[model samples]
Target: MEITHHNKTLSLNSPVVMGILNVTPDSFSDGGQFQQQAHALEHAMQMLADGATILDVGGESTRPGAVDVTQQDEIDRVVPIIKAIRERSDCWISIDTSKAAVMRAAVEAGANIINDVRALREPGALEAAATLQVPVCIMHMQGQPRTMQSAPDYENITQEVAQFLSQRIDACIDAGIVRQNIILDPGYGFGKTLSHNYQLLAQLEAFHEFGLPILAGMSRKSMIYKMLDKTPQDILGGSIACATLAAAKGAQIIRVHDVKETADALKVVAMAVRENHELGE
Candidate 1:
């Protein structure tokens, strides 16, 4: 399937890698690496060269218990980088934010997508997205990052997430966002316990019942590292494993840190799936 945004459509019939660029000081991983514009641009170029189809930029760290940064701080960190990237590359740039002001500024700075873990539920978020008319990714997080992991719960993880996403879609529609410009993410690590995270991944395809493109972001999170008794710095292998599973389950976009490995793994999966299709002919 293809995800069309800002008059551009990304054909994700095969799995695609979306490299993560965090321009903050406290993201779960790769935090300080991109705070400087020069360094951030260089790393972004490297991700593109390594075969990233999209680059997701986040100014705020959404890791549980992370303190909130002011709107101006968030804008200052992302806009310049977005402007710089847009001038140099044609790759799809998604702003990872929950704030409406950030969405408006990032789009003005040339972002093509809004990847909000809050799913645009924040005040003015829907209005801002509608006004900008860019593609939006509505992700399911159980609660605010500060307290999301406090006491997560679910009767049926898959149905609950799918239902949550469905409601968000309707909310966006109510705010005047177009169907083709929307995508859904089940929020793999935002507020989920280990079991909850794995449950969501195992039943990922159920989200397709909503008929929207699914983006999976399981890159080096606690879900994998903690389960393996490893640290985030040592989760590349886990990341690839998760990426492969997500691809096999019909995830259109994989948000990740190690772009080359993720890209190569996805290539193998995509080739196999494509070959199977051709043989069926």
Candidate 2:
């Protein structure tokens, strides 16, 4: 399958790596590191060279207990970086924002995908995404980012998540967002407990019943760090392991911070799948 937007296309024949480029001052990982426009562009180029097929640029931090930024501030933070990256390379660029204004600005600046953790539930989000006409990744978050992790209770994690995503899919279609342009993300750390996160990962393939591409973004998240009793910077191995597991389970997009390492891990997964297919035949 392929996602096309404004003369750009990304093939989902195999799992692809999406490098995280957070230009915010306070993301969970790599925040202040890329706040400068030049630095952000440099990191974007490096990720592309590291085998990332997409660069997900986020101007605001959605980390637990994170404060929200004004829509204009978000646009100011990301537009120049997006424009600079577009001027440099044509790799798939995903604007990771939940506001309608940011979505419009980023796409106007040059973003091919709208990766909203709110799943387009934010007031003008649905309308903006429908008008943008680019691929939209609707993630399932139980609550707002500030308090999502406080008390994430779920009787049946997979079922509930599936139900939420199903409803969101219907909502997107109703909003004039084409079905083929919709993508699914289970929102690994957005609002899930540690157990809930793993359960979702183990049963991620269940989401495929919707017939849309899945974007797994467990990279350097609490799901890995908290489980390993390590910090984000110390969980590269764990992150890659999770990415491999997600890809093996049929996730088409693996969003990650360490693009090179995740890319290398995906290569091994690809090889194993090829070998298995050949032997079975």
Candidate 3:
């Protein structure tokens, strides 16, 4: 399958790695590291070299209990970086934001995808996404970022997530978004408990019923650290394991911090899966 964004088409015959670039001061991981123009640009280049098919640029920290930034502040934080990357390469760029203004500005600057954690529920977001005509990744978040994780509960985590995303898909179609342009994320670490996250991951393939590409983002998240009792910086192995599992389970895009490592791990998974298919044939 492929996602067509304007003049670009991203193929999903093989899984793609999306590098995380947080141009913010307080993202959960890698915050305050790429806020500067030079630092962010250099990191973007390195990620490309390390096999990142897409760079996910974000200005706000959506970590639990994080405060929201002003629209202009977010735009200022990400647009310049997006422009710089656009000038350097035509690689796919996914702007990770829920604000309509920021989404519009990022695409104007160079983003090809809108990866909203809120699934475009913010005011004007659905309209902006439809008008932009880029692939939109709608994630399932149970509550607002500031308090999503305080008390996450569900009768059936996987079923609930699927239902939520299904509703969002209809909303997108109603807002004039092309059906094929929609993607789904189960929203790992967003208001989900440890069991809930793992349950969703294990049952990820269930989402394929919608026939949309799944984007799995489990990089350096609390889902790893909280389980292993390690810091974010020390969870590379865990993160890679999650990425590998996601790819093996048919995820189209793996959003990660360790791009090179995840890319290498995915190479092995792809080859094995390919070999298995060949044998079956």
Candidate 4:
């Protein structure tokens, strides 16, 4: 499968890593360090060197219970990094934002995708994406970040997520965005409890029912640490384990933090899966 954006098409036969670049002071993990242009740009370069096909740049912290940020602040945080990255390298950039204003500004600054957890439900979000003409990764979250985890429950994990994504895709189509410029993310930890998160991952291939690319944002998420009874800082093994599962189950993109490690592990999985198909008896 491929995601077409900004006149460019990216192949997703093997799972690809999207390095996380948070330019906020409270991104749940690795914040404050990349808040400055020099620091952020340097970090982005390192991730690209580590083999990330896409760099997701986010300004505000979407950590559970995190505070909301103004549109201008998000614009201020992401545009310069997008501009600076465009100046140095040609890595595709995805603006991890929910606000319409930031979506417009970041794309103007050379971003190729809008990774919105709200799934473009915000006012003017669909319109902004329509006008910008870039791929939009719509992630499904049952509730807002601050309150999503309080009592998260789903009657059927796979079906519920598929339904939500189907609605979002229909909404995007109605709003004038082309089908080629669309991707779907199950939003692993956004509003899901531990069981729900795993269930979705176990059944992630079912989302191929939508016929769009599936993005697994399972890099050091709470779902991993919670299962291991550890913190996000100490869950690399779990993260790799889940990333491997996501890739085997047909995920096209794995949004992650441990870039080099994830890239290496996925390289092996891609080769093994290809070999399995080739030896068809």
lDDT of each: 0.92, 0.94, 0.95, 0.91
**What is candidate 4's lDDT per residue for 189-262, written digit by digit as tens?**
98899999989988888999888888999888889887899988899989999999999898988999999999
Candidate 1 lDDT: 0.92
Model 2 Cα shift for residue 130 (angstroms): 0.7
lDDT tens digits by residue: candidate 1, 91-148: 9999999899999999988999999999998889999999898889999999899899
How much is the lDDT of residue 38 in candidate 4?
Answer: 97
Scored by lDDT, model 2 comes in at 0.94
RMSD of each: 0.9, 0.9, 0.6, 1.0
| Alpha-carbon TM-score of each model against the true structure | 0.98, 0.98, 0.99, 0.98
Query: How close to the true structure is residue 68 of candidate 2, measured as C-alpha lDDT?
Result: 87
Residues 1-281, candidate 3: write the lDDT tens digits: 88998678889988999999999999987889999999999999999999999999999999998888999999999999999999999999999999999999999999999999999999999999999999999999998999999999999998899899999999999999999989899999999999999998999999999999999999999999999999999999999999999999999999999999999999999999999999999
TM-score of candidate 2 against the unseen true structure: 0.98
Clashes of each: 0, 0, 0, 0
Colliding pairs, model 2: none
Worst 10 residues of 4 by lDDT: 1-10
Residue 204 local lDDT, model 4: 88
Candidate with top TM-score is: 3
Give the RMSD in angstroms, all C-alphas superposed, for model 1: 0.9
